[model samples]
Target: MRLGSVIKVKPEKLEEYKRLHRNVWPDVLKTIKACHISNYSIYYKDGFLFSYYEYKGNDYHQDMAKMAADPKTKKWWAVTDPCQSPIETRNEGEWWAAMEEVFHLD
Candidate 1:
């Protein structure tokens, strides 16, 4: 499976981000699924957000580009984008930092 990661910060206000994600927009959900992504998850630590997604196709970069071009994805990003910060240490075009997998218990 292909893997990807993203980062977002804890909102300055109370429970705003959590609430928004609790019912993510249907169009946004559809856009992600259309991109051939599945088994998605997000985690938080030390006030940093980490997202993981698995892809099941050969054309990852092209699919990601399509996802970015989607209007729904753009709208979703407009809302959730403010909650994120790019990792300062990553190379350019890296919005999320990649995590090195150390172990897999499962």
Candidate 2:
């Protein structure tokens, strides 16, 4: 499955965020792969970040919960979350505003 989301990046934190993403921790990458996420990418434009990733797991929510529960992942978020400003359109408890895939051809 494919997933995508959008979030606002604070202007001041943009460069730092990019630098962090450039060399995400090895353990963190392993955790993400363990959660069945692949082809993950984040693009930036005008202070907005667009993220996309593919899920190979059957249980999406459960895997997400597991990812969220990981200690290292939690620590990672502590540093990254401060750089993001979730859009107003994001629902309660959502850090990234999920997007609808209007079209896809493969």
Candidate 3:
């Protein structure tokens, strides 16, 4: 399955956010793979950050919980979270607002 989400990057921290992602922690990457996510990518445009990734697991929620529980991932988030600003219209409990896949081909 494919998923997409969006969030705002604080203007002041945009560079730092980019820098952190440029060298994402190895353990965090491992945890993401372990959670069955792949082809993950984040893009920046007009102060907004968009993320896309493919999910290959049967239990999405369970896998997400596992990712959230990872210590290294937690530590990574602690450093990066401040660089992001969740959209006002984002769903409750969501840091990145989930996007609807209106169209797709192939």
Candidate 4:
């Protein structure tokens, strides 16, 4: 499955966000892979950050919970979360607003 999400990057922390992602912790990367997420990528434009990734696991919710429970991942989020601003319209409990896939080919 493919998933996409979007969030706003604080203007002042844009560079900091980029820098942190460039050197994402090894353990965090491992945890992401362990959770069955791949081809993960984040793009920035017009002060907004968009993320896309493929999920290979059958149990999406369970895997996501596992990812959230990871210590390194939690630590990574602590540093990055402040650099982001959740969109006002984002659903409750969502830091990055989930996006609907309108179209895809291949």
Candidate 5:
């Protein structure tokens, strides 16, 4: 599985952001599971929200398309997406900026 990261602004609408994640509407969770993503998590520091996820499926694009097709995910994005701003230099058609994994020692 490959690792990925994306960035977004700390929500100015703090309460709403917190509320949505605190509950994470059931369908959203279902969508995640259906996509074959696991150990997903998000963190915030220095006014930036960082998301980390692992993809286990054979085709990431197809899996994500499944995610995008979900009505619940679409609704969830409508509410949460406004809280983020993509990095200026991030490539087009990409939501979160990606990080390079230079070395792994295990």
Candidate 6:
């Protein structure tokens, strides 16, 4: 399944955010893969960060829950979350607002 989300980057921390992502920790990467998330990529523009990833797991919620329950992933988010501003448009419980798939071919 293809998933997408959007969040805002604090203007002052854009460079630092990019730098941190450029060197994402190995354990974090491993955890993500272990969760069956692939083809994950984050793009930045106009102070907004958009993330897209393909979930190849049998259960999306379970996989995501597993990832969230990981210690290393928690540490990683502690560092990264400070640089982000949850968009106001996001749902009540979402740090990154879920985006709808408008169109896709193939």
Writing each residue's lDDT as its tens digit, candidate 4 over 1-106 gives 9999999999999999999999999999999999999999999999999999999999999999999999989999999999999999999999999999999997
* Clashes per model (N, Cα, C within 3 A): 0, 0, 0, 0, 0, 0
Q: What TM-score, to 2 decimals, does candidate 5 have?
A: 0.88
- Give Cα distance to truth, residue 20, candidate 2, Å: 0.2
In order, what lDDT does every prediction score? 0.77, 0.95, 0.98, 0.97, 0.82, 0.95
lDDT of 1 at 80: 77
Could you give candidate 6's per-residue lDDT for residues 8-106 as a string of tens digits?
A: 999999999999999999999999999999999999999899999999999999999999999999999999999999999899989999999998887
How far is 41's C-alpha from truth in model 6 (Å)?
A: 0.5
- Runs in model 1 lying further than 4 Å from the true structure: 2-14
Q: Of models 1 and 4, which has the larger lDDT?
A: 4
Model 4: lowest-lDDT 10 consecutive positions: 67-76
Question: What lDDT tens digits, residue by residue, belong to model 5 across residues 1-106?
Answer: 7576667675676556767899998999999989999989887776676777778898888999999999999999999888788877678787888877777665
TM-score of each: 0.86, 0.97, 0.98, 0.98, 0.88, 0.97
Give, for candidate 5, the lowest lDDT window spanning 10 residues.
Answer: 6-15
lDDT of 1: 0.77
Q: Which pairs clash in the backbone of model 6?
A: none
The C-alpha local distance difference test score for the whole of candidate 6 amounts to 0.95
Least well predicted 10-residue stretch by lDDT in candidate 1: 5-14
